[model samples]
Target chain A: MSQENTAAKAAPGVEKKEKPERDIHNLGSSFIFKPNVIDDIHVKAELGRYRMRGFSLFKKIPHFDDLTFLPGTLTRFVIEGYREKCETKTILGPRAKRPMELDIPVYITGMSFGALSYEAKTALARGATMAGSATCSGEGGMIPDERRYSEKWFYQLIQSRYGFNPHHARLADAIEFFIGQGCKVGMGGHLMGQKVTDQVAEMRSLPAGIDQRSPARHPDWLGPDDLALKVEEVREATNWEIPIQLKLGAARVYDDVRMAAKCEPDCIYIDGMEGGTGAGPHLATEDTGVPGIAAIRQARKALDDVGKTGEISLIYAGGIRNGADLAKAIALGADAVAIGHAALIALNCNKDIEEADFPNEMGVEAGYCYHCHTGRCPVGVTTQDPQLRKRLNPDEAAERVYNFLHTLAVECQLFARACAKTNVHSLEPEDLAALTMEASSMAQVPMAGSQHTVGRPDMTRY
Target chain B: MAELESRDSHDMGMHDEQLAGRTQQIFFKPSAEENFTYPGAYEVDFDKETEFDAADMSNKDVNLKIRDLMSQGYGSITIRNPGAKHSLGVCILNRLQLTFDGSLGYFGCGLIDGPNVHIKGRVGWSCAENMMAGTVVIEKNAGSTFGAALRGGDLVCKGDVGSRSGIDMKGGTIIVGGKTGMNSGFMMQRGRMVILGDAGQNLGDSMYDGTIYIAGKYESLGVDAVESEMTQTDIDWLEKKLSIYGLKAPNGVENVRKIVSGKKLWNYDNLEPSEKKLIL
Candidate 1:
């Protein structure tokens, strides 16, 4: 038999059908071949041709969902929900002369006045006061209204030196030296000309309708030793009455935490990958910094390595949503948790607008809004426009924030009760378990239903 | 140092003991004078004057003592034999006058709100940094980042200043008697910098709304820093600032080169890519 005839005869009843070429338009793999629509729109279309505007890039990344709490069942005893009392109060910077004592472990992270409306800032302060927590004055100068409403306030000494006044520094309960933020780790803050109103310009001492770009690093100091001296300067400036906190983004978390601890700050504040910003470069927000879970683990380890675990307080920010997240952070060794995007949400950020004009008035649907940098927010929480800002009444918005904080505290207490912990701080890494191997390795905790830890060898002993 | 010891203990009766006791027990305030001497207090006598040294104590202790004295409203402190100590006379709230008789270290008189600090010798980095509504006079040379991030005050460096002098200055007058190192008045938003001697390269780099008056030879200027005609108003302002520090202009007003913000780099909307590079 001929070779071709023999081959065809060997595979009896097999059809010789030719396969068509694969389509390039719809590649099955989303990550490798296809271009991300969001990234293309922002990088290629918007910022590619013009100056960068203020808008945070939203992307899906690994977060707190990978971890889960191992509730008490047979080996551990869970407290009765009805009769037991779980403490939610937390103290920060206990080594300092005047440590910040909070009724609840949750605090409002720094969000500047240039970024948010005056009403929104006041509302945050009032809400934090009602919750017996603290609110921070962000990059911009401290507003009088916010100070009037807030019981305890943290003042940020950012690199820009915008609206930085000695009077405000002295007035703050604690001073936070803002080294970097999570949204844009190595980059500085940007406020577009549209957002620079007369009030904003006056506060920052900049020209009206001018784009303000803050320096990425401080002009005064460079290295960790220099930072230590600067910390001394701030301590002296506040008469050593208020605690000094070093705020850093979660990039090189272990090294950054170590350096910040060496500066002898009373507290170290770490902002992770999921932290929100008023505005930032699209590339920076999407592809920079470590996640909050991983950051907390490294920060705790760094503090422990330096033998300053409890000596210096650790405040964690980024993607902290509710009481469960707060409980998880505390368990990972955070003295307190700060909320930014969630606080704005509590102030009606993405809520449905019931006005008659509705979508037409804002030029966008309520639920799909993320135009905080435009200075024309429909919800009035992020806008500086007088008309838009009027929509957010400080008193009413404050009540919502209060309710949100109350709910978080209650939820945290419930979690503590489940773990049979008397205080929220008593929840340790042993009480947590990871749902995935990635999370188990990063958090150094045992995988679900397994006695072996993913990264550490002797975590079972913990 | 011996003059400080000869002062009568009875003369140190300015602060009431009860008020001092109450203030000391409060947050961040120094406790009652049990072991050490309160430098600013007139009635309080030191247990061992020779042993008390600001260099030996922490910046917290030094500042707390200064603040305690300032809290009494108004007073004078004579820090004798101060050897380059950081954060001397920092955050003095009231109109207390601090006289440093020797060299000081980094952040000396930093964030001075209302105090008048006189340093008789040279200072280390960031002397009078972020000073607000106060007067800081460095009798000799100042280290790098001198008067950095100054908000509202007068900082007079009688001698040369290091690099990045008067950086990010807002609403203040910084007078440098001798030469200034690189990037003087860099990113200065508002204020006036008067340089009596020569300037290093990148002078007034990226200055937004400040004025720079150089009476000596000028090196290369930074982007957005332009030489404008010196006006009578500029001369008058310079004279006023110099008079406060008991200084005289090294050169005539005609010889002075007045540098101001070009206002071209204020907004990036109209600027070309090349122009942006020039300012950035």
Candidate 2:
């Protein structure tokens, strides 16, 4: 390290110190206002509006990695991984005459037809059906092909009611009343003008070539009392044969879940801040809703308080990536877990395929792309454009999705067997230890190598 | 600033050519197929009249009986004492003459495609919601959220209707013989609403695309909802619609104030450089 070499390797903003002991005019950097913060400010100042993007949270929070499962030893007996059966059967909305039954404990959450191209939507439906899982008809309504390929499907009755039809609703195995989602809570959905094609526009009954900002409130029902009637109306329309699930964003989970239970839905789904969206204000995604670890616990507690625990099922979605995350969610009391972004990833969202030039096309590297809002998805998962859509082969993508979903179930079973649980639903909170204090408090689990749980009145008596 | 403007697709390296029939197969094309096969398209005879008393039966029993009747080719059906049960006569996708002799509850006759329904008594909220092609006539007063998300056909209430009538209406016509509650036709996309009597506050608020004719006084206009000049064509249509429903506007049809969208909130116009689409 000669002085000349040091000067060449120094970053652009660095003030080269001539003397080793000199402290004059030397001020440390800001944690709040980093270089990225300045970059955000500069962009907003130029744009005059909140910047929009498609992805989940950009900032790190206490996540599943902080919770480690405690395998069995002398105190507990471990079920043999290779021979024994770890039942992955999951049932949602059991109160209905025909509950939504799944071979695995995981399903693909709704991601609307307008946000994703035809190939991507159908491929997802086919893959989930192969895995004996379910898929939802997100916001802008159902793609006919997606329905044809899917075995079990949920028709979402969103607040916007974009493309909602009773004829279509009757075709579903279940009905989901989408009140809100985790990524951008308290806001309606967003479909930029670029993605609102002629067909998509017709499906949603909106004008073409316009930024379709959906209404956040339901046009029919105004309050919980009204919602109760609305739910009854749907049940009657479905001949009381299918289950009805309420999907809400994770905010004030305990109170929200209690109110949701009062609505008399067969199932309640809470989406955490880790949920991804096709398009939304970037700030909303970063600063809205609680994490999954905390949301599930509060939701489960709320159901218990209302004495609707077994009568009503709880499903959690948001930031769920792998088998470990699935096991952790089930352990935290979620009967089933739903995934969105990870499913799209399996459909080749951010892949640097030979058909795509990620750096040149997306203005970012393949792994760093978060530009689904612009409808220029490099790997063809989100775009409606014909050329970009061609990049994703549905046959190959469907197989990949099935493989990924199959892998997730196996991995979750692995943990269940190691924890001396013969059934995936039997994974309990007692088997997990929190590595961080924030995680310990949020998940309500004891700290690693200690009997104390953070935020509890009796911290030492877990 | 000009150099930084990546407004068009070419700036972001997206292709401009519209590749036809290449990337997407049959399902992607708008003109290809409807995708879903509509269920319960039963054939029935109009002369085969049937009347059922639903006083002692639950809502399910009545609905199932209606299905059984429809499957047996009975088109002219009447139900006595519907008990104002919610979700009565829902998802009827065929043409039939249906009659409710008593007042109905919420979501009555919803999601019907082609049916001529007559309700002799007053109805609760959200009657005839999302009706594709049918005529739902309530002789008495109707509750709030009347004819919500209605797509096609006509929804007529001889008496007053509650708030948020025709909210998110995609198509069809809503005719209120008397006064209506506030925020009627909120966020309405496409449809025609005729208010014969007074309207509550915020009439036609934030409506995307629709025509609202208010014959009587209104409390106030909402965001992006502005009054427009009434044409002779509008007068003729109102006169015909009123005649068909056997209701008269207090004043003549020519005096009704026509309201439409101001077209101000449709587009923000500040497209991020990448949002500008050059690709079709």
TM-score for each candidate, following the candidate numbering? 0.86, 0.90
| Best DockQ among the predictions, by candidate number | 2
Model 1 interface DockQ: 0.20
* Candidate 2 lDDT tens digits, B78-182: 999998987789888888999999999888888788989999998998999889998999999999999988999999999999999989999999999999999
Q: Candidate 2's error at B27, in angstroms?
A: 17
lDDT of 1 by residue, A1-462 (tens): 788887656465778656798887974656643566655666555332333433344677667788788878888799876568888787888877888888999999999988998778977887887788889999888876566557788999998888887777867889999999887898788787778888788888787777777888787897899999999888777656678999999999999999899999999999998888877666678889988888998999999999998899999999888888988988888888999999998998878856314367656677666667677777788777877876776667877888898888888878877888878889888888888877887777788888767766675622
Q: For all candidates, what are the clash counts? A: 3, 1
Q: Which residue pairs clash in candidate 2? A: B6-B273
Weakest 10 consecutive residues of candidate 1 chain B by summed lDDT: B19-28
Docking class of 1: incorrect
Which sections of candidate 1 miss by over 4 Å?
A1-57, A356-363, A456-462, B1-61, B71-75
Displacement of residue A113 (Cα, Å) in model 1 is 1.3
For model 2, residues A159-263, the per-residue Cα lDDT tens digits are 888888788888999999999999999999998989988878888888886778888988778888889888887887787889999999999999999999999
lDDT of 1 by residue, B1-280 (tens): 1221332223322123222111212222222222222232233222212213565666667667655554444366777767887877776655666788889888888876766778899999988788778788889999999998898878999999999998988878899999999988888889889899999999988888889899897688887889998888887877777887888777665577899988777776566655656643
